[model samples]
Target: MTERKRVIQTGWNLENSYARLPKSFFNIIKPNPVSSPKLIILNYSLATSLGLNGQALQSNDGIAVLAGNQVPKGTLPLAQAYAGHQFGHFTMLGDGRAMLIGEQVMPSGERVDIQLKGSGKTPYSRGGDGRAALGPMLREYIISEAMHALGIGTTRSLAVVTTGEFVVRENQQLGAIMTRVAASHLRVGTFQYVSKWGTAMDLRALADYTLQRHFPAVDAGGNQYLFLLREVIKRQATLIAKWQLIGFIHGVMNTDNMAISGETIDYGPCAFMDTYDPETVFSSIDIHGRYAYGNQPHIAEWNLARFAETLLPLLHVNQDQAVKLAQEAISDFTKLYHYNWLTGMRAKLGIFNEEVQDEELIEGLLSLMQKYHSDYTNTFLSLTFDTRWDVALFGSTEFAHWYELWQERLGRQKEQKASSHQLMRSSNPALIPRNHQVEAALEAAVKQGDYSVMERLLDVLKDPYAHSTEQIDYATLPAISNRPYRTFCGT
Candidate 1:
């Protein structure tokens, strides 16, 4: 018998749509190659979607390309320049430790950015070492993939590679690099960059380019910039509403981290809520709870406002008229966000129709969850199953009252009871990337060099809504000892 040998292809169909912009938009730079490149993981599913051969990508030659040791042919790499408002203060910042290697044009005609995060230092290093620890790199890989599975708009991870070196964080740790794929790296901060530093023409050119790339349906009629602003608001509204429905906290809501494409970018310090609390905050730097679970919608609108400011020059000829138009667009954010949030909340509660009392019922359940400190995901998941535990979970009388009201609401729906149950089941996930589980996975990987735990967690999270008796432990909440929890930015 003859053994089958694998064939490797080294060709990549790379494009540089972003590089076509003026030279001031970005700085061309090369990634600093690592000492010893080691493949941590390769997302075969994502690779296939990007029109790349997964088997070829895992080859020795491909691992070198992923680790910054070798650049793929026809790839033009550069670090993008953008300014952002960090914690309410504007500052000039860019791709400090990341580079856009190239754009992959999929077979379906969709284009996505291929970026190497934590690759090496560039002009935007900001006097810091351009490296990333293995733990945080793995965290982004796990959470970003989990987000995609949950049907949320987010940047996907293609591969993670170890640098076979050490990086200094709180202490020395193993260095790594993450390959991030996104619709585009354009951000609200990118607009702010041109608005603050570059000329008016630069801002207009960027707006036009962004429209052509992301929102092409919007014709360039009079006041096209204003139309662009409204479109961005709608995307951000829907994206943040999905986050809120799942009790996901973004942790860092800086303008730079908010992608103009409206997908969730930058997984630093992000965590899913365990107990139901509107004020839940896991990011250690969010001492003021500015970007807390409940504050996400408001923060999103604020970020969009900063984005709008960048387009003021193009919004209208007169400065005052531009401000008026921008204000009107910004004012629509709250209504759009509330509508999205309520729509998702209805689906989670198995309510298929609109009713004025729907908001009250949703708030009532949440208020009870907060009062009892009940598990958020579990409480919602339980709705799709037996109700015997509900009495004990939310207290006998309190849950009975809400349950009765909920049943009456369901009775009013035109859809059958079974259909509502299915809706609820699909909307509420049985498992999330729990903080304790994530920490445990990271610990095993960093301390014992074990990746099996992470692999198992990813397997369970891949089907978040499905209930499997054997994988039940992944749905459980963390012990009390893991309380008073906090997450860092991994800087």
Candidate 2:
């Protein structure tokens, strides 16, 4: 490529809508350049969706831009200011090492945030190195893509770039940066920041901007801020339900980590469950299991309650009436969450129609799985494909009775067996980002600098619902070890 061509950043189509907000909301800053930038992985599929030429993005200039060594034109990079209740402790926080470069307007006219994570420190570094490690960046890439393939709403990884520098953590780790794409970077914590520090006008402006950007469909005529809380509550209800259905433990559901867009935001200390244990805790710091596999729904409600608190002023002129409105919205969260979760569980079980006893039947199967330690993802896969698995567990007489009940439940529906099977196959993925497999892939890429394993893993994970033979190897469970699997907040 000619010097002139390389200098001209291609396919950016950027819009600085968020930067136009009040100065206190963000800091217009540029990324701290890295010495040498190398391409790790480029998401061509996602790139195409954003109207970017993947081939061009693989070029030297592209790698530089991704590594934060170069900023593309039309990009007014800014580090957003926000605060959060992390692990239930309120604190001030912001994009300490991340930058929201700009929004990319897709062919469909949808605007998405294109942020480079682990780029460098900003005004919110909090006296720490604003750098990221290769393992965590790749972890986010693998798991986020896996979540997308599994039909979950999540932030997408655009690319991962390795900076030829080391970051000091537990040990010296290779530093890297991740290109993340999201509907918007607005979070519940954004509201918290304005509510705590900014004036009521700032809070209202943030709420209005969030509604216009994300929940545009909501009627804005009356009590729109209240509607904003309701819309977010509903999205979060369904989002958490999806997370539960897939046995995903976010490990950290702090207010800052909860995106107002309802997309799964940070992948820190996040992992999928191998066994059917409700109290599974993977994050090393989550000793109390506040964000455990089963506690996600309640935690989501808690986060939404915090969000509702931020909107109390705008919800009504009277604090009492506002509290009532917020309480009503939060009260509906449990019903909405249960309804969404039950619907998802029914789909996973191949139940065409819900029955009054469906929850009982589902609970019975889960209890059996918990007692037998059946693999979560594969259990559903076995039910979907009629494949023999963990015969010792499936061969139990109690399981046989549950299977009979499930069959009877399915028979009640007018849908054919094939249609029911199809629903189950789609709802229950043939593969998930198994904890061991992800570790192996990350180990290979991080320590050995061999991305082939991760590449192969991503290839199969791209179509998690296919139930193809290629996924079997990826689907197999890891050997049981006495040591528990632990994930760290690789920030």
Candidate 3:
């Protein structure tokens, strides 16, 4: 077999961004050196898709590049600046602990941002060592991969490199860096950063650049800022709806965490629920329950308000007119989000068409699921074959009555029985990276040096909807005793 050669682009596009603004916006710095860099996990498949040789990824140089010990030939390392609302308090937060190494124009013609998480300190470091603990690093790798498998748009982990050092968090913890890939790391807070600095010109320039890059169709129009605002709202709503349907809690839904590209970017303090609870929260620091499961939609609206506020200056030629236009854009978010959420619920219930009472039927099913404390993913996946979701577990013969209601709603769908069944099965995943399973894998890797468990979990997570008898263990949720697995920010 001819050896597949590894390809590296010779130079970077080196596109300077908002960094052209005041120097206080961001502090430029290189990543800190690690004692011994070793690959804990490598996403070889993602590399191949980005026009890289799978074999070359196993090379020592590959580990060095991934560990942030050496920048790639075309890489441009810089920290992005942005402000975020952390724990309901507006805070000026930047890429304190993260660095955008550069942008890569993949063979597929898509430009992906190559970033290193836990790459060391920047101006935004806020008096802390910008290092990541092993548990949160592994959690991001697992959950981000799980999101991709669940057919959601998200940041992808390209590789994980251990620093061979300890990061002091809750206790001394292993340190690691995650090579994260995203369409763009531009967040809603990026706009806010410029807006608050009395730099409307930069904001407008950023908006134009963003529209051309992400929303090319809108680049030709008047009121393009409003167009970008509306489109971003739509995508974000759909993304949040998918998160809710999967029983995933983002834990931190800060405005800064909201990506303008509508991708799930930050994985800090994120967790998946084992039981159906509308108010479930898993981030140890989210004592206020602000970013709980049921509060996602409302929080989304709040973030959109922040985005709208940032865009108001460029949204309309007149200042007062701008506020009105932005308000109009913000208004579209709730309707768009609820529509997407309802449609997702319809598929979960096997209802494929618009019926006058479809929304009620969907709500009825959710109410029963909540009352019974059912597993979210399993309940949805099981509806394809059987609507009878463990009546005994529901603690009531009333589940039988609810199942009958579900059947009646299913009967109204436009698709025939077999087609609807196929649609439901395809849309609902049979597996997710259950919290317990992820914790178990992380424990083995961090404590026992057993990465095989994590490797196997990734394999199972890749084909989430597939029925694999051998991987039956992957389908079960964490036991009741392990119901709410807490996630953390490796502080």
Candidate 4:
């Protein structure tokens, strides 16, 4: 077989619509240069989407750009300023170690923010070394790409490069940088920053610009700020529902990490649940279990409440009336969330028609899973195949009772069995970025300098719903020894 040659482009087209914002919004800071920069991996598909040549991005000059040693022409690199509530404590937090290189306007006219993560220290370093270790950077690359392949909205890793530097954490480790692509870096915390520090004029400008950029389709005649709040709530409702359906847990869901664009932004300390448990908490820092698996919907509501407060001034002339308006919008979060969540659950169960009893039926399965400590992904995948793991719940009288009811319900739908089966298969993935599997890959890469595991994991994750006998091992639950696994924040 002839070896296929890789394509290379020598030029880049970068724009800076975000840089056009007032200087108060961000700091014009350059990345702290790294030593011995070397290319590690390039996301060829993502590069192509952004009109970048993948082969060039892996070259020497590209390594310099990725390592923050050189800035590409037409790029305005800067660190964004934002405040967030971390572990319920309000504090000022910015890009400490990351910088936005610029935005790329693709041929489709969609603009994406290109940022370098773990580049180096910035003004917001907060008396800490603003550098990233290789393991965490690679973790983000693996999980984010997996999320994208699963059809979830998320910031993507465009490339990863080694800095040939060392960072001290629990131990000394090699440093690295990851290039991230997102719709925009605007977050609920971005509004919080302007509201708490910037002037009312600044707040207004930010609101107007956000509308122009993200919600241009929103009707401008009425209260646009309120419209923005409603839209954000709707997107978050849908997003969180998807998260729950997939058994994914975002371990650190602080306000700053919640992107206003509705994409899953920060991937630090996130994991996919193996066993079904409502109160599962993985982040080592989540001592209080504030951001648990079941708490996600509630925390999402809480974050939206904080976002609503920032828009109160723009909501109405009278503070009292604005409060009332914001409260009304916030009230819709539960209804919207439950509707989206139940609808997704129905699809996962292969139910084409919804009835009043659907929610009860869905909750029953979840309750049984929790009670039996069943594997989350396998339980759903079993149902898709018209079979059950005999060990989990299939043999239980209660589950059999529920199964009878489910069968009757499925019979009522006009859709054929094959159609419903297809829906169930697509709705429930056969694979996820499992915590144990991810750790194994990271250990191989960081300790043995073996990236083959990471590459193989990515190959299976790219088609999460497919059934491949050779890759069936990826679908199995982790062993008991790997139980109660904890994830840590990248910082």
Whole-structure CA lDDT of model 1: 0.89
True-vs-predicted CA distance for residue 130, candidate 2, Å = 0.7
* TM-scores for every predicted model: 0.96, 0.98, 0.94, 0.97
Span of 10 residues, lowest total lDDT, candidate 4: 1-10
Better of 2 and 3 by lDDT: 2
Candidate closer to the true structure by lDDT (higher is better), 3 or 4 = 4
Best prediction by TM-score? 2
Full ranking by TM-score = 2, 4, 1, 3
The models' CA-based lDDT, in order, is 0.89, 0.91, 0.80, 0.88
Worst 10 residues of 1 by lDDT: 1-10
Q: What is the full ranking by lDDT, best candidate first?
A: 2, 1, 4, 3
Candidate closest to the true structure, highest lDDT: 2
Better of 1 and 3 by lDDT: 1
The positional error of residue 348 in candidate 4, measured at the CA in angstroms, is 0.4
List model 1 lDDT by residue over 1-491, tens digit each. Answer: 11112212643567898898889999998769899989988998889888888877777778887888776666789999999989888999999999898998887899999899999898999998888999999999999999999999999999999999999999999999999999999999999999998998788889999999998888665567888899999999999999999989999999999998989999998999988899999999989999999999989999999999888889888999999999999999999999999999999989999999999999999988888888888898888774544455556588889989999999998999989999998998878999999999999998999999999999998988777774589987788774588999887
TM-score of 1: 0.96
Quote model 4's TM-score: 0.97
Encode model 3's per-residue lDDT on 1-491: one tens digit a residue: 11112234222232334345456555666767788988888887887776665566567766776777776653447888888788778878888788887776777677878888988888788998988887788889999989998989899998888999989886898899998988888898888887887476677777887887789887464778888989999899899989987788899999888888889988888888767888999888999899999999999999889889988877777989999888888888888888888888777666778777778777776777787788887877667667555665444666667767777777766678888787787778878888788889999998998999999999988888776775567877655673456777677
Per-residue lDDT value at 293 in model 2: 95
